[model samples]
Target chain A: MKEAAGRRRQSAAASPCAACKLLRRRCVQGCVFAPHFPAEEPRKFACVHKVFGASNVSKLLQEMAEQHRGDAVRSLVFEADARVRDPVYGCVALISSLHRQIQSLQAQLALSQAHILHLRMRRTAAAHLASGDHITSASASSLSLEVDQTARFY
Target chain B: MKEAAGRRRQSAAASPCAACKLLRRRCVQGCVFAPHFPAEEPRKFACVHKVFGASNVSKLLQEMAEQHRGDAVRSLVFEADARVRDPVYGCVALISSLHRQIQSLQAQLALSQAHILHLRMRRTAAAHLASGDHITSASASSLSLEVDQTARFY
Candidate 1:
């Protein structure tokens, strides 16, 4: 255990994390920023650091439970990257965009429902006509949209 | 403008913004935290500061244009509040929920689409029968689901 700790300390000192590299500081052992902000992805730490300073990020990580720190860091990094790309809207913009997509999909569902109803009505009229019932074109077009719910689903 | 600034300074000193009040510091003239983190809503700034220190929040707001600062502040406040409530997922949870809703909506749309196609095929079979094509019940009931896409739409 002591040997492993010693090696980690030495490695941490030699290869600082992205946060420490950006701030020009040595990454000490058990750094709150080290695990989340790896040295390979320097831009991740840069954006997070620019949005939320290292001191504050450090404090936040220290405050949260170890299990949740990864999720928290991911959320922070995503928000930070969004903030940099869009200074005004950020993550909220994506939320609204998703909302718009949902709205459009709902509209499509409604249209499909109406089309289905019309087709069902036409099929009913065709069945009646084929069964020797005298049905005019005008009457067929005026067939009701409402039908037996059980049969409509099939 | 100078008179207005002076009045703001006096009011700020007396009322001190939420950020300053929480930190037990004076709300100085042109404090970035004043406008968005009003004194009436101290919890807003409290959460934001706890997650991403007041200094970092202030810096983030200052870096953005004055016109966009309000929106940026709103986003920060929402993210901070969500973070406090959900230490792990935060706003990402809401994003995932929206995605789930979209998925369900898509499923509904697909079902409706299939229903429409089935209805169209039944109507085509009924039309052939009504025209005295001598189609039996089994033949009519086993109508092909595939039909002209343009005709299926209606």
Candidate 2:
């Protein structure tokens, strides 16, 4: 144990951590040694590292997907340096980007919803205005056969 | 103009900003006065003046809200000199705090989402193993009820 400690002292193993490894520095030991982190480290670093863990990349990705909608990917890339190379960084980065893409799709869905609502509102207004005619030529012209294509997503 | 520039050099009353007004200090013109800023004395004054112009408070509030979920507030407050009672510094500090608070909330929300997913996965595994009629019994439990609640959110 003494000899191993001496070796560890002489040369810290290159931590696979993307941030520490990218910087080519000794790993101050990864998240295990990072208890001084979330509990005691000042608010800024604590908040960042608490959500982002070395061994817990899957959790981080899950959080990114469910909450920030993929903003975490850009942050993860920025967080990585020479000393940190956990392959999970790449996986999570991909996940974050995918999450962002999903969010973009969601935004599109929302706009489409609002548009449909608007069309319904207009139909109601038109019906109020016209006592007899159920189908107006102006409204019929606005209706696109594209509804069949878009409806597949629902 | 030269005499006025020399004589009017920053009176206690004509000081550039509201912060300077309260602090009773000279508004040392910052980067906003240089190459990007206008050269004429009135225009030079306008640069700093613009910052405190119409809707400044609302703009500051918006910026604060954007950063409210992050540590920006604490850091900004820490940067302010406690010795001074300047509104400029106070406003900046307050906005920073708001930003930090927003970030902390965002992080917490993200964590909650990840935890919900984890719980869902756990229940799914448990359900898969629970045989036959026992599945109905397990489904009646609180964990399954929580899953039903979570399902509504997604």
Candidate 3:
């Protein structure tokens, strides 16, 4: 009895139409057989399987492409790269490189301005010293302390 | 008559009160004179010839300081910076430093992202080559024909 039931299940699973499989639509044949087919049958033969038609494959591919946007973009880039060849690719590459150079230049400018400020501060300190007016006490104290340390070492 | 006229001019400028000079308000007993007094006597005295007071000097200084704002800022920065004495000055300095650091970090991040994208593109290129695809003779011919001299050398 178990052998006969397994044979029935195998026939049902193989019976699903190719159109239903490609469309990713449910197979009524597969669904009808699932209830009567014995558990002893292989899982693939538990019901009739859906077949993928060309149109259904195209639709599924589009949906999958939509889902994996990043991968789709990467593949499209690869395709254009293959088709138009290197002209468009080279232009994109050049633009990106120029953008990097601009960023670097801006960063360098900021760094140079900071250095200029530092130099200005040093000049100010020197001018303050040159003027008869007492330079700020803390700076004077620090200078004196450095001198004392040197004197101790001497 | 010429000596009398010269004497009268000397008496007009030789006055201590700038207000009286400015007002064209002559003092009967004029006292004190600055070296700025005119060597030759003019036929008529005008209110404009009055010696400016400390108040005027202060106002002129204020106006000068306001006008050369950028110069004043540079001088303040380059001069002995008394930051401990001025909290507002310290805040400006600190803000400038932070802004520089932020700009530098932003540049570094952009550089890093560009590098990553480059690596990813290379990897995708390698994968494309590995996957065997049909390259028709027509497409290959076009690519060879369209290939520029720069690309060939590079």
Error of 1 at B132 (Å): 4.2
lDDT tens digits by residue: candidate 3, B5-112: 999878665653443444454534422212222224221112112111223322323444344433322322221132223222322343345557557666655554
lDDT of 3 by residue, A1-154 (tens): 9999999987756654443443355657434223322334332221111111133223323444334433322332332232133222212333345557657766555554444444444445555655656777897787566545444422
Q: In terms of TM-score, which candidate is stronger, 1 or 3?
A: 1
Q: What is the C-alpha lDDT of each candidate?
A: 0.79, 0.39, 0.39
Q: Which ten residues in a row have the lowest lDDT in candidate 2 chain B?
A: B74-83
Interface RMSD of each: 1.7, 18.7, 30.1
Candidate 2 root-mean-square deviation in Å: 19.2
What is the overall TM-score of model 3 with all chains considered together?
0.19
Best by lDDT: 1
Sorted on lDDT, best first, the list reads 1, 2, 3
Where does candidate 3 stray beyond 4 Å?
A: A1-85, A88-92, A99-103, A130-154, B1-154
Fnat for each predicted structure, in order: 0.75, 0.00, 0.00
- For model 2, the stretches where C-alpha displacement exceeds 4 angstroms are A1-78, A81-85, A88-115, A118-130, A144-153, B1-154
Question: What lDDT tens digits, residue by residue, belong to model 2 across residues B14-96?
Answer: 44454343334454654112222223334322322332231332233234434331232222222222202332232333334
State the DockQ, from 0 to 1, for candidate 2: 0.02
In the range A9-100, model 1's lDDT, one tens digit per residue, is 87756798898888898778898888888888999999988777788778778887899899889988988888789866778788889999
Best by DockQ: 1
Q: Lowest-scoring 10 consecutive residues by lDDT in candidate 2 chain A?
A: A81-90
- Which stretch of 10 consecutive residues in model 1 chain A shows the poorest summed lDDT? A144-153
Better of 1 and 2 by TM-score: 1
Name the candidate, 2 or 3, with the larger DockQ value. Answer: 2
